[model samples]
Target chain A: MTDKKEVFGMRFGQTAGGCAAAVLVAAMLAACTSSSTSSQSSSTSAPAGSNGTVIKIGVELPLSGGDAANGIPTNNGVLLAVEEANKAGVPGGFTFADDSLDDAVQGAHDPAQGAQNTKNFISDSAVLAMVGPFNSNVAKAEIPLTNDAELAEISPSNTNPGLTLGDDAKKLRTSHPDIDSYFRVCTTDDKQGAAGAQFARKLGFKKVFIVDDNETYGKGLADVFDAAFRKAGGSVLGHEHLTKNQQDFKALLTKAHSLGPDFIYYGGTTVTGGGLLRKQMADAGMGSIPYVGGDGISDDTFLKQAGSMANNSYYTVAAPEASKLASAKGFIAAYKAKFKSDVGPYSANAYTAAKIEIAAILKALQADGNKLPTRAEVRKNVAATKNFVSPIGNVGFDANGDTTAPILSIYKISGGKAQFVDQINLKT
Target chain B: MDIFLQQLVNGLSLGGIYALIALGYTMVYGIIELINFAHGDIYTLGTFVSLAVLLGLGVSGEVHGFTLVWVVLLTIVTAMLLCGIVGVLIERLAYRRLRNAPRLAPLITAIGVSFILENAMQLWRGPTPIAFPAVIPNPSLQFGGVEIAAKQILVVVLAFVMMAGLQLFIYRTKMGKAMRATAQDRDAAQLMGININTTIALTFLIGSALAGAAGFISGVYYQSTWFFNGFEAGLKAFTAAVLGGIGNVAGAMLGGFVIGLVEAFATQFIPQGAQWTNVVVFSVLVLVLVFRPSGLLGEALPEKV
Candidate 1:
């Protein structure tokens, strides 16, 4: 009787302890997740003007964790544009300020976080125009919210064509399908993919194998590459869509090796197994095969992550080489001086996007008789933007909100740096 | 057949690292019913320490034969020691307080420690994935149609050697006997003159040391690691531990290899296999648990304190 009673007491005590710990852990996990996702308490870098009127450019990007490699530099570019606009001074005695939000959760860009960030930006009254939500998937989530709120969002890096063209884009903005609120400064994946396919053939690669990171951006880019490469008379051995955050691709690479492709095409960023994939490809004895990707892998991070295997790899950026362009010289120097980091692949494109937004906001204010314009009025002005000279070249939007000044730049990795090779004029 | 052979090599190489991590989880659970959620981060911490040490020693871009062997051994040892100390501190500070508390308390505490370690690493190393320079030169070894990597062989051989050495230590060493006694029944072992605290701390020491080695090996193998790498890698190791019978030592080693082989084979043969790798891995886990609730090597038992 005594032994059984003690046993019961011990078990009961253990159960009670377990229950208490469970609640504490549950509460902590909840707190941790919420704090990580909510980067909405962003600081404004804009100075208060003499008129005490501050107009804000809401910035949303994957500004933390692994995506920071691309997103931070992009954010810096946007911030730089706002600083310049503040110095130049708008017509309405309004100071242009930036209110940024991070859509990154844990270490990568997340769509749900992007949606929440969009809501936060929409709730802010001072924000008339927004300058990001970089990834294509994040843009897809954010567009509906911005559209419903009549807030203008201009992405610097989104390349998926479905975000701007066809029935697919119409589905994203159900609130105002006729009045497009989403615009991107970069060219579409179709142009990039076609350019890559033709380039691969020119380099004498007859057989190609394709892989994607299995995200909206990656899959879309790979699909375009597949169709274009096939039409160019290059045999596509196989195309595989890798699971998100799936680290190991040795087996996939091994399988691709047997198919005996001369080239491997990856449609993903450095953060999404892009660098590791090429390194493992070398381990599978296919390291010498030229690897091609869209702008996602064109960043310097890709070169570092791909290591010694980075050589012979080629990628296409859907924007001009901002560093090489004479018009972009001042922006690049300013970006470097401010961020203490070299201009990333999409930094100039983001700068151009921000500049366009500021220009439209000033234009809207001018049309409003030097009064602060409504989100709708500012959005309309942004949509009406045509042949606005900027760092990345003449910026304009078509009816569908795709950049009219579409240009694709090709680059090859040499000495662990991306060397500009050729430019394909993507504008029809 | 060639694909199969190649994947076999890939699986074995990957499995060796998982087994090392799983051993830490299993040993901690065996000694104390606490899950040690931070075990995975301990592995990650190991990798960072190894990287720091390597960089400090000016080792980068593949060291030659003798220098390579010496530096790898030195770096792994330093990582293991640092990780072992951290494991001990974690137990002494966190798990020790909750040992007699409800089982859920320590389990939750383990998770808290996991976050703390991950966040701390993030703060130290920033958010982006840092590339570890290749320490081993890539060379292909031909076996008919199958080609194997020298690095793969090193990972497997080193893992097995450590596991074997651990086995000897457990069965032969007197401290090992004390640890076994403590694991069997804490109260009974206390009455039998076994120092329960020391034994438990020692268990954490060995387990975390092995995990640290795993971290070093994985970092060297993968060539890139982020602060969050440990979380996913930890889950996989935890799965291996559970698959092999959580408290069983030899079981973790076997389970690790099995999971690796399954993932590799599924990726090679399954249509859209890369997408289905986790589904297949978890499916096998569910199926195995349904048939054998105690896992493959686990003896049937009710809840224990």
Candidate 2:
């Protein structure tokens, strides 16, 4: 019996040792392959201009994961802007090429992979700016690295208020003091959340139950909504946090039903429990109550997943309706003709971000008089962007590196599509 | 009181599903003395297969009445059969060789199988949570100011029937006797003319079938399933198994229901319970293990010489 115990212990030790060795080897191999691939791609991506100067803009997005629905369209938008810029030509005659990187590892936005992609972008001297990282969590990881390198990154759809300004903003700045390096065309959660609260009050929902996916973006938005709703003379019945990607919300919904709230508010994207929560709420006999959410739930995926339950739901988006904007008509038609699909949620914002970046690059080039501007010069130009007109609206960056034109468009789900209801111009 | 009763019904329905999964964990662990960690992924695979079958049968957009019943029944059967075969194959290919080669070998192999199954499903379905069509039309039956949906009824009834059937099969048949004997002593059972390999395979087959049923019910009831669904469910079910006594069949079932009730009541009564549901459930496990180490129904197994 003693010998048997000893042998068992030995075997356990061997297994642990073996597993450790295997993990270390796998890590090393992954690093080696990623480095090699980045170098090869960078070398091949350099397009030959008239003067032999090629500039690349790194596009980091979760191209093949749960966020792919948003990421792929956003990538296409960036690609379209780059195509147009190449055709239009920069002042220095430098060729613009897109070096798109998929920061998704194991079918999700992995922070380590996002950080690695940032490093790859920083290492390549010709790459000037980056546009991407649809999800706020991925933005959180990539921002610090870009900040340290003084590389400018503009996200089309990161709505977490903490990333730009607020108490969390101060915390973020303390970690990476180069806070101005990160910019987003998309409005923050505070504006969207406050807009949603005002809309709820406008719709006369007195008591509301809030549920969040408990991630950085969802929880932050929910907190903002909760505070804003209370301050607006609306009573909050209850607040609940749910695990992301959780299919079942019956128990939570059942509890919510008992409270008898006027409506339900979800703070998360469609992929992360928003759609299922709506469906389950309907299943729990709350089908008639209107559901409200931020821009995260303002997508075709939410409409498809929520099915019939989507009818009375409302969501807020940072951009105006594509049809409403005269400048967006051309981009929308071109996007449809090229992609064979309607422009997704962040595609227009991504296009606007790319255009903004291109305009900054042009400014830098013209300042230097037909000479290539340094990355720092490009970063400065991007920060100083003001009164620049784009397809979305008048694009500009404020003191906090947030968009000056922060418009929150509310859409109601009717006929299984998000229809424009009202628009709120938020004060920066 | 109505709210409490309503929460009870909700808890029971959720418990029923967990009980079904916990049975698989207990049964496999009882016989092989190895925790089959891949069992949850097997449940996930069952949901995927059922989803594919339902889609193939063109059961889309508001399936109702007899057609709904038939489609659901057929999907469950197909999912169970496929999952059972897969389970047996996993046991044969992976666990068979490592049966006597240290306890750690089979355990590690089970985890490895789990990763393979999860990654394979992710590749096949693309990491996003696919909207499972609500095949079972939800019609709540109101009684005494409490609401109980048809899906909950279906889940509870089917789970009880499966559990009863499993109870009978394990205690009353020749194959069942062989299985019991193998669980007691594998070499000794082989000497008594029992086909040890077949008995072990049968154990895996039955356990996986129950998990498959669980997967089907959850997918249909919740109207969504993702690749990582199994991991969380598996962890909870494993907790149930340990709570009930890791190797006791009845204990596992009881533990599952207990955990389910705990989670439901926690969400209903505790402040911020929805966020603390997992915390409460695991706390119950810790408390139970502290008070009753051998589990509520577990009899300490005789030490092997």
**Which candidate number maximizes DockQ?**
1
lDDT of 2 by residue, A1-428 (tens): 22222222122112211222342243233333333433344456556544257778898876664445445666778878888998886665588877888877886666678889889999988788999776666677777777777788998877666678866555555445745788988776667788999899999889999999887667777898999999999999999998544456778888999899999999877777888889878767898999999766765556667888888998776555555678789998887676555565567888888888888888888888978778888888899998778887888898788999887778788777566798787765
Error of 2 at A11 (Å): 46
For model 2, what is the error of residue A59's alpha carbon versus the real structure, in angstroms, after optimal superposition?
7.9
Q: Candidate 1, residues A1-428: lDDT per residue as tens digits?
A: 22222222122112111222342243233334433423443553546455248888888887767455556666767878887887776775678877788887997678899899889888888888898877777788889999899999999877667789999899999898788999998877667777888788888889998998887667777888899899989998888888766667888888888889999999766677888898788888897788998766765556667887989899876667665678888887887676555666567878888888888888887787999889999899899999989888888999999999887778888777667887776666
By TM-score, how accurate is candidate 1?
0.76
Task: Tell the DockQ for candidate 1.
Answer: 0.46
CA RMSD of each candidate after superposition: 11.9, 10.1
Residue A332, model 2: lDDT of 88
List fnat, each candidate: 0.58, 0.46
- Residue pairs in candidate 1 whose N, alpha carbon or C atoms collide under 3 angstroms: A17-B102, A18-B102, A18-B104
lDDT of 1 at A60: 87
Tens digit per residue, CA lDDT, model 1, B1-305? 87788899989988887888888888788777677889989999998998899889987888888998899899989999999999999989989988899888898999999999999999988766788867877677999988888888988887688778877887799998887777778899899998888998899899899888998988888888878888878888889888988877777877788888888898888876887888998999899899988787883123354
Candidate 1's C-alpha runs over 4 A off are A1-177, A181-184, A188-191, A322-396, B136-138, B299-305
Per-residue lDDT tens digits for candidate 2, residues B1-305, read 98888888888888878888888888888888889999999998888988999899987756878887889789999999999999999999999999989888899999999999999999999876776777877778999878898888888787677767776887798887787789888999999999989999999998998888888888887777889889988988898889988877778878888988888899889877788888888888888889998787763244434
